[model samples]
Target: MSEIQNKSVALVTQIEGALADVSPSDRAQSFLERSLDLYFALGGPPEAAAKLVTQARSRAQLRVESAVANVVIELAAASHLSDIDMIQAAYNRLDVELKAERSKK
Candidate 1:
């Protein structure tokens, strides 16, 4: 599996280990501490992983919104939208956007 997937599995294992403890608050605190330690190990700063996750989610949302806007504008320019014709145009625009993002990377 990938590095992130391996980290996720380790997180699950940590939570499972904590589940057998007697105190609920201790278990929760332990889980959070373990998770934060892993994030710090992987991302350096305490908040680095969280920032990366937030940025990734924002980027994904922007991509979806951009693709939808492109579809609507392109279809509107043609003055009519059928039930299925806009699918190809929208996907083509998303493909272009993906290429652009990849090039920047």
Candidate 2:
């Protein structure tokens, strides 16, 4: 990975590790909210930290979507299904399932 990508991944991983130590009982705050709090606590500039987090989140989201698309393509090829409409429907179904799983605690 490039330096920026490596740094972003490291920062996100550090934030996630710290978040894991937070009390699970406190479920009121969202992850970004908590992550921002941690960033400020660690002496990072709020504006810069927010921008970094936003960029990292977007990259992570794209990676997930790409992975989903690859899986859909692989499955279609394995099943010998080459119809465009059917592949699109499969992708849509997988996207919905991914969203549903993400919504769960």
Which regions of candidate 1 are displaced past 4 Å? 1-23, 47-105
Q: Give candidate 2's error at residue 22 in angstroms.
A: 19
Overall local distance difference test of candidate 1: 0.53
Show model 2 residue runs off by greater than 4 Å: 1-29, 62-105
- Tell me the lDDT of model 2 at 84: 48
Best by lDDT: 2
Q: Write the per-residue lDDT of candidate 1 for residues 10-72, one digit (tens) a residue.
A: 444443543344654555576557546645544458556678757856864556458557645
Query: What's the distance in Å from true for residue 95, model 2?
Result: 39
Superposition TM-score, candidate 1 onto the true structure: 0.24
Q: In order, what is each prediction's RMSD in angstroms?
A: 18.1, 18.2
- Model 2: which ten-residue window has the lowest total lDDT? 4-13
lDDT of 2 by residue, 1-105 (tens): 655445444444444544455564453366447546645655668669767957866864556458557645754564454344644554565556556555763
Error of 1 at 31 (Å): 0.9
**TM per candidate:** 0.24, 0.28
